[model samples]
Target: MQAVIMAGGKGSRLAALTKDEIPKPMAPFLGKPLLEWQLEQLKRYGIRRVTLVVGHLKEKIISHFGDGSTLGLELDYVEETAPLGTAGAFPLLLPKIESEHFLLLFGDIRFDIDLARMERFFLEKRAECLLFAHPNAHPYDSDLIVTDGENRVTGFDSKHNVRTGWQDNLVNAGIYILSRDMLRRVPEVKKTDFEKEILAPMAAAGEAIYAYRSPEYVKDVGTVDRIRAAEEEWRSGFPAKRNLEFPQRAVFLDRDGVINRYNGFVRTPEELELLPCAAEGLRQLNSSAYLAIVVSNQPVVARGETSEAELETIFNKMKTLLGREGAFVDDVFYCPHHPDSGFPGEVKELKIDCDCRKPKTGMLRRAAERYHLDLSACYLVGDTTGDIQCGKNAGVRTVLVKTGEAGRDGKYAVTPDLVADDLAAAATKILEEQ
Candidate 1:
């Protein structure tokens, strides 16, 4: 309902790029204030009322956003009388956050989060706290490692508590959601962290702390190298995704053919084989920071050819494989309904023609609602005309892959915006345009 942005940090690490001019939150990327992009993302997600916890270079932020009028949002500030750590900001701004539960985001990072979904998830799951997390990037990525099955946050890595053999290689996303009452309990001591003190303690105490995985690309522009990596990533359109200099977009990807495999209907991992350069292509899109998604129609499940549990088995396998390869799906959407036929009992579950199936942007539209995605700037990638038609019907970009048979026939007269032999090549072209 309400959002609080931790925009007050000095961002000591990015001094070279900021020209000693502003805090990291105000630092420019592509001639736009870093905080502006964050504000825009909030607006996209239907968060019109926001509170900025400002301390370092607080004036810069206040002057730029000045009442948040231009953005059509009510903007307020928690001018910390003194510098408080990340966790402290929450308690300090608690008075201003009116919602029973609200969102917390670090201004230093650039991410595309689906807050609408997160809120509903928080309520339905009845969680006290929920954090966004992803796989640790490399040898020295800063994040809190999750344990207790991501249900309880068991550890914090400083660079502390880091040990090899960490299965998920998962790390804290620096994004958080907490109940209003949780803030009242926060200790008001000097110099505290949400990780070492709050989250870890809560988990250890058997609190309902949940870790929400992005399953896509989540980057923190904290270091010079990471900043460059992000810039390069944007320029190259990293995951074979299209680049829009100033366009609002939410990308839609076909599951079987475009994302994983087009082997008829993907029923199991045994039948699932990722196409050539699949991970790399998706990696490029991930880096470009698009809202990467997988939308598929698995009729086989409806036909009783496969079970839902079996479908999850396939996804679990795909998730591991993709994460290892450095390209992960953000959110996956599938339709198990089959209209025409079914196998015995399978028809009961799969008999209806649902709106979520491809050729209909229902799933895409749902994702847009949840993520605050701008579907008008969206793009859809598939290997069939149906995919193109889906994107067309959704009023977004439609691109076809020539690697499949759909491109062979002249019947596909709709003319895809960009045709690539493969996802990577197409992603490369999208990057070039950016």
Candidate 2:
């Protein structure tokens, strides 16, 4: 696949480091230029052809990696005689890119991502544009993204935008895969922003713009402090070793009490009702870097009160309700085994101890493996002691919400790290810590 690196910016924020007549992308990082590191990563990912859009100190970049042969890449250059904003350089390369879709990235960012997976997602969705989004340390002052249940980009909020009471923490990571047709949206003006002038407007008009939210390592070293942190992260080998393999953080939840009213076991779709603000609570996580996962104990399946197919229908209805509110859960895992017997229609085989049941950590471990999660970095939110114990056993932080049992008369083997009134409040606590 082809990739475009926008290396023309003067990077005034990093002026101290780039004061030696070198562009920000050429600034020294760990004994080599930052751009060289990025090129090596691209080459490692099997991307051999790259186009460098150069302007500021263009000669330095050209002299260092001329024709990209030293890096085993087919190099091309687009010299912007005058300043064109982020998306402006793209219009100039419309005639140069032969592929229908090409990767676009900013030169100032440092990241270790699975580009092949991103490409597959972009193709699977048939999206006109797909942006890489993640949660940063400072969401309050970052460009946030608003997406629907399907990960479609519904709105883009720049950092300058006034804060609403509660917002999603997912921010644009400054990487994208753009279909050639998206070039039509680029303004004819010499200078224009890709976010402000192109992508946001297209999304506002209901175009197919999606956000690929992952917990992979993507950081912009635009300041001194961040550059230092990036170097530290690299030296620690956390980004290259763990993040590249499985880096998503998750918020594990209990189904009945946490997501819906818990009068009794929900036997049918018609009986399911969402708890107050539950959809909104999940919507916040849906737009953040955390994966919304449901780990529930459903003993009724073993008692023959509810069949697996019927349970799936109920979950689907719940998802539909959440989608109406622009919310969603990434995955759901339920344990159907019950350690009792002698019920009238009980499934004899399932009435035994199972590892996936609550308080056993099996479900959480499975999720950790499937999504490449770091258990310690995850959080488990539930209304019962079993949920808290499950989280503790899995080595994740735990929160107890008062919506179900109210944390009253609770006799359990473990205590929650925090307690909240409901799911929404629990989400607030989690984001505050972030």
Best by TM-score: 2
For candidate 2, the lDDT comes to: 0.83
Minimum summed lDDT over a 10-residue window in model 2 is located at 238-247
- Report how far off residue 56 is in candidate 1 (Å): 13
Indicate the TM-score of model 1.
0.61
Could you report the Cα RMSD, in angstroms, for every candidate shown? 7.2, 9.0
Per-residue alpha-carbon lDDT of candidate 2 for residues 219-291, written as tens digits (9 for 90 to 100): 8887767888889878877576535355678999998888898877899888889998798788788656688
**What TM-score goes with each of the models?**
0.61, 0.67
Q: What is the lDDT of residue 36 in candidate 2?
A: 94
TM-score of 2: 0.67
258 in model 2: Cα distance from truth in Å? 10
